[model samples]
Target: MITIGELGEKIVATWLEPQNYQILHHRWHCRWGEIDLIALDNHNSELVFMEVKTRKPQNWDQNGLEALNINKQKRIYTTAQIFLSKNPLWQNYNCRFDLILLTYIIRKNNSNQGLIKILNSNQIMYENYIFTIKNHLKNVL
Candidate 1:
């Protein structure tokens, strides 16, 4: 079974696909850390390194924002540098760090009457959870 975090990453990738973003890598790792998603903007010739966070509404950490502390950012930065060193083609492209935040909302309504009304463009209703894209912070790091 796919973990919640992984599922969130997949959802983010799917969302980006329609916007002309080509996914270069997923879960790229090194000694420092792992990057959840790496994508290239076909329109602007930019490379994006994304960190995806998935969480429930009632939890702490500002829905995973607080979890990305200074130390974690540094590790991700170092890992990005390592990735650049290995991938020479993408090295020349403009690079940026982005954060994708997703929230998992439990379905409270049994009837389908309000389901269509509740969902917006950035939300998806899965089995028993509604995954919503809470925020997309570009050039975060």
Candidate 2:
């Protein structure tokens, strides 16, 4: 099963794809840490380094943006530097950091003995799940 973090990366990647962003990496890691998504913004000719935060609707106190504290931001910035060093092709492009916060809500379906039905053919114990982009902040760092 895909973890929540992985799912969030995919969701953000999908959202960016339609907006003229070409994904270069997902979960790119270095000695510092992992960057959720790295892409080339075709529309702006910039390299984008993104951090994604995923949480249940009830888990966040003041939106997920608060989770990207100073230390986390520093780590992400360092990681992006390492990435650019390794992938020199993007070194010349302007770079920017972004944050994407996703809120996921899962609703219980008690109609069929706790089974959630979908499309009248698929049934899942965990169903009626919805994901929304609670925030997308560009140039976060």
* TM-score of each model, paired residue for residue: 0.86, 0.82
Q: Please, what is the whole-model Cα lDDT of each candidate in the order they appear?
A: 0.85, 0.78
Q: lDDT (0-100) at residue 106 of candidate 1? A: 72
Error of 1 at 54 (Å): 0.2
RMSD of 2: 5.8
Best TM-score among the predictions, by candidate number:
1
TM-score of 1: 0.86
Over all chains combined, what TM-score does candidate 2 have? 0.82
Displacement of residue 40 (Cα, Å) in model 1 is 0.6
Per-residue lDDT, model 1, residue 75, is 90
Report the Cα lDDT for residue 123, model 2.
Answer: 17
